[model samples]
Target: MITHTTQSVSKANIFLTCTDEKYYRDELIVEKNTVIRMISGEMKIILPDITYVIGAGDTIFFPRNDLAKVWKTGKDGRPYKSVAIYLTPEAMQQYAIKHHIKPIHPSPRTGIKCMAAHPLLDSLFNSLVPYFNLKNELPESLAEAKVDEAISILKLIDQEVFNTISNVEEPGKINLAEFMEKNFMFNMPMDKFGYLTGRSLTTFKRDFKKAFYTSPQKWLTQKRLALAHYQITEKKRRPVDVYLEVGFENLSHFSYAFKKQYGYAPSSI
Candidate 1:
């Protein structure tokens, strides 16, 4: 589902897409720093400076001024499906000032990329992604509240990523570890991931294990099944509905994955 809303004063647009499917290769012209969150599935972001193949748990912050190409790659070297949130800078700045935090500025380094797998940040991203997608007019107080939460998460990420940059080396070309954590919803296609990175599939898998301490496929499946569990328990809806809602195309596949992850049938829940 894609949702769109605009702020009257700033005329900033917020676009939201929540899907259990893959997206096609495309580019967005955003006038502000756009936060892309992977609610489910995998996404391959091809930026001018770097290409990021992010899984469910991962996110990429594309500053407003940059132009980038994005592709949705699926498992089996195919384009994986994904959902995303897009926000304009003016709206984001308003959210920031209301929360008493400085808005994100262009990094001193051109094309600087920051990646982290903080749980709070993930939650805040998840919450706001939908909020901005749904509302027409945001009251000043509500906007401030959302801004505060977002800022808190951003500050934590800043401290964790920037303060410790020296200790981590170049932080790796791709934040595979963080991607896996944030995108625990499906298995990433090693071949596709490699293709994006200009690496052989074999080499990509090897490097992914070395960097993330896990195989890409295994990590992705675990995340997807876990997300399925969460959605089932939290939604209070029918089991079959949850299945399709979370991106599984068929009941058999969904049931198999659910039992594999939780050792129970969907009906058990």
Candidate 2:
């Protein structure tokens, strides 16, 4: 089993995440625009259309309201370590107003944004490493200052990323079928799916029925199970490996549902 740990600097949105195991994998529903600096080891981000790998000394950005599968791995006997700073809407708005910043042009990219090496980025993240050893929590004001400094450095180094982070547009109504088809494997609540696809709960269910000809719950389960079945049988993956990756919360439930759907347990495959 993987031993995962995270340390934070008080009320600041910054985080230091580590894992002792050789590899750790999980899913994320990013709630805020986030920048991560890889300190050691490597991280691979799997998106719907692409995958991004970040190594030590690499800086990458994840936009808000995106679903991704992240795989982290240790290297050369060292644990995986990274510093992640979430860019809050309030902070972005405040910085924009204070700096007289406006969106230059909308970015068409949906995948991870990678930036070239810069001294300011390196200096900021290096200074944060020692805070992990502190006994007392850092003050909120100091933490916010660090975040603000990062925002300023970003504006100077990468304007495209600066614009992407500064803009906080709500998701507009998009094609429900195309969206759901790509994102059905993520384990989110019905309402959250609705919100991300720009619909209310009532509208989500109604539109889901029209698009899938079935209830949301039923369609999601069937699709997840079908994908799991393919992975287990065709790809020769184990039941344990396939269950969580397919959105089932537990092994027993996944086994029960797999048996019900195919008239046999997943392990039998």
Best by lDDT: 2
Summing lDDT over every window of 10 consecutive residues in candidate 1, give the lowest-scoring window: 162-171
Cand. 1 Cα-lDDT = 0.52
lDDT of 2 by residue, 1-269 (tens): 55656433433688888777766777898889888999888888877667788899999988888898888888777778888888988898888788887755556644568879999999999988888787778778788888999999988998777777877788789899999999888888999999999999999999999999999999999999999999888999999987877788889999999999999988887
lDDT of 1 at 239: 75
lDDT string for model 1 (1-269, tens) is 23232122221233444332333444533234444566555666654335577776676666433445555544544333333333433444555566575534333432425466778766766665545444466465665565445545555666532222112111224555654454333223456456444467787788788986887766666666766777678865667655543435578987888787788987788
Candidate 2 Cα misplacement greater than 4 A, ranges: 2-11, 21-25, 103-109
Q: Please, what is the whole-model Cα lDDT of each candidate in the order they appear?
A: 0.52, 0.85
User: What is candidate 1's CA lDDT for residue 262?
Assistant: 82
- Where does model 1 exceed 4 Å of error? 1-14, 19-23, 73-114, 126-144, 159-269
Error of 1 at 265 (Å): 55
Cα-lDDT of candidate 2: 0.85
